[model samples]
Target chain A: MTVPDPRFSLNQWTTRHWPIPDLVSGCVARGVRGVGLWREPVAEYGLARTAKLMGDEGLTVTSLCRGGFFQEKDAIAENRRAIEEAAELGTPVLVLVSGGLPEGSRDIDAARARVAECLAELAPYAGSHNVQLAIEPLHPMYASDRCVVSTLGQALDLAAPHPPEQVGVVIDTYHLWWDTAAYDDIARAGAEDRLAVFQVADWVTPLPEGVLTGRGMLGDGCVELRRFREAVEATGYTGPIEVEIFNEELWAMPGPDALTLTLDRFAEHVV
Target chain B: MTVPDPRFSLNQWTTRHWPIPDLVSGCVARGVRGVGLWREPVAEYGLARTAKLMGDEGLTVTSLCRGGFFQEKDAIAENRRAIEEAAELGTPVLVLVSGGLPEGSRDIDAARARVAECLAELAPYAGSHNVQLAIEPLHPMYASDRCVVSTLGQALDLAAPHPPEQVGVVIDTYHLWWDTAAYDDIARAGAEDRLAVFQVADWVTPLPEGVLTGRGMLGDGCVELRRFREAVEATGYTGPIEVEIFNEELWAMPGPDALTLTLDRFAEHVV
Candidate 1:
């Protein structure tokens, strides 16, 4: 039997229903050497305990799921805590989903400005913790209520004001596939050494109401997933390739079943 | 009683159920000087009759909704018929929704290439009719199932190889507001004289299933409608500003009432 690629990381969200301890064992059983974790589950499981559990299982925490939401109140403090969490977890990267426009606010420019301000404050704290802030530009559909940073180019621009070691950008196929400039931006990200994390998901259509939780399982939709992995690899990013999907049906399955299906898809479509 | 701006053209789809004659008379009564039309309604009313009615009502046809589903089997022949219809209606702009990937296809790059080929075939026919082929890039969310052309930059790039008089791009705020490069692309469109038509519609979240028909009435969402208008005008584009909305609630209302509400919203938030 072929061993799973060591670079393959199952983002905790892919098996969102899986408890931390089970997730660790499941990854080990399936030969998934790394994982991209979310803060909520880690805190719920006790961050230190979760860290020890992963260490015991020889599982590397690839990156923390998120830390931005700058439009929220006390964003800097919140992100600082996130950086500390990444440090404690021994993850080298923290994903940032920069929040959207403030409620009832039409000025996206102002909201984007606030993100920069929050990042400026948190970058130093993140650097001290040795955690690189990875700006993940959510698809443009989420620009209003999720993240105003809607393009990989914009994410790279946001990270420009910070040290490359302290700040970087994420390359997610589901979000960036539709962008015509994605290839050029990917090259730019690589050349600048800002390609921190790589993610894969396909783009399925007739997006459900709210358009969240409708992400496609790899190979079940239209995204060119392997191409994105190759692009990031071209950038010398010999790091984790996280399968981050947010499908409702995927969550309804038993955690082990879901991970099994995801690993199969990841091997077939992504790696 | 404030006068309606002469540049405000009520697009037929904004009041989708309104008959052609009723739409023309309603615009005339409201002091609206222009009307943007769709091909289906024009055909249903008889193209000659619709044209004569608009002429009798002194309502200019600002543009014809579309002429480009390039992925369809009969796309070229069908687009030729559309160009003929636009010429018959005396409209100078033929909006092109270049269509999505061929069914079950994942190669967006190839789909985009097909759009260019179709444009090359249609540009001269459209030019002969004195109708500009205006490529309208729908928001990226529609990239998979609606239009592969998902950005103003890509639209402009597609239009670049053609004569400015023959091929141009549409600036629709509803489809473009989330883009960070929108302003720059708008300026580029104007500089190249490829700014053929300007459209407005607010974007409301909780996108309905299918993610279409969820467009907001102006001022009812987060888009900066006036800013988009100003950006287009800044490009020396003095053409009619088409109010093109596709909301189920707006479509369900009485045509005259919807038109009245649209005029009010336009004056308050978009002028």
Candidate 2:
């Protein structure tokens, strides 16, 4: 049997319904060596137990799913806890989905400023935990509700003030593929040593209602996945390429079947 | 009765079902001095008849809705005819929604280049007709299917090659309000004399399926409508401000009532 690509990391959300033990064993069975863990699932499974299980199975915790929803009142304290969790899990990266506008707020600039401020507040704590904060810019469609950071350049700008080891930006193909400046920003991210986690997902059309779960599977949509992978690699990024699709159909499939499909597509289209 | 804001123009698609004759008379009755026309409705109403009706009613045609699906085989010829129609209707701007990536094609760069090539072919014809081909950069969400030009800066870049009077850019607030560089691009457009048309539609969340007809009514969402207006005016743009919403609920209203609400919203939230 062919071993899975060494760089292939399954983001937990890809097989969201899979029980923790089943997901770990399924990844092991498939020879997938890396997994990005979401905070909720890790917490639900008992963080220490999840960490011990991955460690025992010789799997690397590639990154913790997220830590930045600065729009919330308790965001800083919550992110502090998230940083500690990442440290306990032995992951080097913590992804940040900066929350969008405050309730009924038309002031995007203020919201963005708040993200920068929150990063400054949390960077030291994250750095002390040896976890790099990876700011993930969502697609512009989610600019109002999900994430205010809507471009890689904007993410880089937000990360500029922080130490590269403490705060960096995520280059998710699904979000940045539409940006004309993405390639340049990728090169910039590398030059500045700010490239953190690289996530893969495809862009599909006629986006579903609420526009959140309609992410296309790798190789299924028009996104130049291989090209994006090469671009990130060309920027000296040798990090695990996390498959983070959010398609409902894919999620409906049994976890192992979905993993097999994703592995095949990732090999065919991304790597 | 108070006259509608003199700069206000109702894009016909905002009242998609309003009959042309009724729409014309309704605008006249409501003191709306300007209206933007769409190609299909104008063709159905007879382009010459629509022109004559608007002229006879002393109403200005703010713009001809669009003319730039360069992905189509016969785009140049179609746009040439659109230019002639815009000339006949006495409108100075022809809004161009540069078509999306061709069927199953991922070469956005090539699609964008096609827009430039088509512009080169149509600019002279449009210039001779006293009409500017206004490339309207859609929101990034529409980048794949509706228009490849997805940022005001990119629209300005595309317009840079042609004479400002012959080729320009459309600043639709609904498409550009999320862009951080939109304000700067507006200033650049003004400096370059490339601001041809200004349109408005608010953006509400929970985007419906397809995401096309989900534009919010003015003042109903988070857009800073009046601020966007000030930014345009600050750039010396004194042209018509077209209200071009596409909400299903708005379309279901009586045309007159919709017009009244829009005018009221414009006065309260946009002017």
Candidate 3:
């Protein structure tokens, strides 16, 4: 049983190779339901202008791509700014890829502690603005210099200590398909009513650039997407299953073609 | 206190570019204690000649490089040959990288079932030959297509259905450091008296080919080598630590230089 597409959201970066109006008109013309954008694209288009543009196209801003990077000392002010922006755009969830191990810090536990403390402080400000903070666990290969929340279990452990409803976790397959704990974590999150988003991507070989460039488009690698969707759905998470792939190749392709391909594959495999 | 050098065993392939006798002589001249020659080397040198050469050099075959690939239809015959090879080398532990999912099969759980069942059949043969089988939990990236056992916990679980003393697991850093479950699994294995083998290697970025040729020489990456050594040592299994890296760049270097580099790094980071 395939789930119907939410049909509109265009992650701005997905269309970064294209212009904002092009992406909006493309989505609106094709009956896509909403848009998920980032700070830079919104800034480039001017936030209010972007908001007005989305409003004019009847597109909902599902999420804003960022806000955390809590491991850095200067992260505080920047994160505060992100919260303000999310409030401005009225993004329901502000996705946060917590920064990796601080330079010269060998202690991962301490890094986790740092992120948790930072999030606790940031969460209240976000809650006040009704902007939910979602922690995204990047892959473990990124443990040293990227997100320290490398597993769903670790993310949940960090999240459980915070207020239940104000903060949650984002399930991005590219960052997590390798995790052995994923199935359990997805169910656990849904049971807790905190599965903010479920994202899909594949795991291709010859990992490019080592960080973000290697994210495979859906069905391009070995991930069992339907099983992941089943795991999430079994927990009653009926919300949008976000297709948020960070693929250099796909981005280079025409935006509409990529969206069409993603939607087509999403329907066939992930739902 | 650091343990004395436990005879450097030449993992046959480490010096595949050289003949078995010459590789052993080179290792012995450099103060290496042993050589873990493979079946191909033994076949070329003649098993008796290989054994005599190592015997003449006062080297110990700590463990054979491998034995398992047991998921095949012809597994019993293949495993029996592996037993004979281990017996010939007088190697105590036959390292087994429990291979990845079988082609035409999508159920990883079922693939794991095949491993356990095959191991049960192979265990009797190994026991008869007094050959200990060591399961290696390869890195999770290799989980889908290389080893179904991707964590020490899963390896332990597979081992659980067998005798702890006969069936053990190799904690190879190159295959396992990224695993968050390593510390806990090592501790648990130590408690269970099943800490089989400890292999060390560094993880260089942009993992070469995503298959082979990317393993860093020890001390080249951010792996907490000493921390892992301490964790494994706490398990009371202070066996020889093997430095195993399959790097094309290192391979291009003279074998003796590579050996020296590996040994020096082992002393500084792992001893």
Native contacts, share recovered per candidate: 0.92, 0.69, 0.21
The regions of model 2 sitting more than 4 angstroms off are none
Runs of candidate 1 with Cα error greater than 4 angstroms are none
Candidates' interface RMSDs, in order? 0.7, 0.7, 3.0
Candidate 2: residue A128 Cα off by (Å): 0.4
Model 1 C-alpha lDDT per residue in residues B1-271, reported as the tens digit of each score? 5789989999999999999888888888888889999999899999999999989888899999888889899999999999999999999999999999898898999999999999999999999999999999999999988899999999999999999999999999999999998999999999999999999999899899898899999999999998998898899999999999999999999998999999999999988
Candidate 1 at residue A202, lDDT?
84
Interface DockQ of each model = 0.89, 0.84, 0.37
lDDT of 2 by residue, B26-96 (tens): 99999999999999999998988999999899999999988998998899999999999999999999999
Provide TM-scores for the models: 0.98, 0.99, 0.92
A176-224, model 2: which lDDT tens digit per residue?
8889899999999999999888999998989999999999999888888
Q: Write the per-residue lDDT of candidate 1 for residues A152-257, one digit (tens) a residue.
A: 9999999999999999999999999999889889999999999999998888977889999889999999998988888878878888888999999999999889
Reference-based lDDT, residue A139, model 3: 76
Candidate 2: the clashing residue pairs are none
* Residue B261 CA displacement from its true place in model 1, Å: 0.7
Candidate with the greatest lDDT versus the true structure = 2
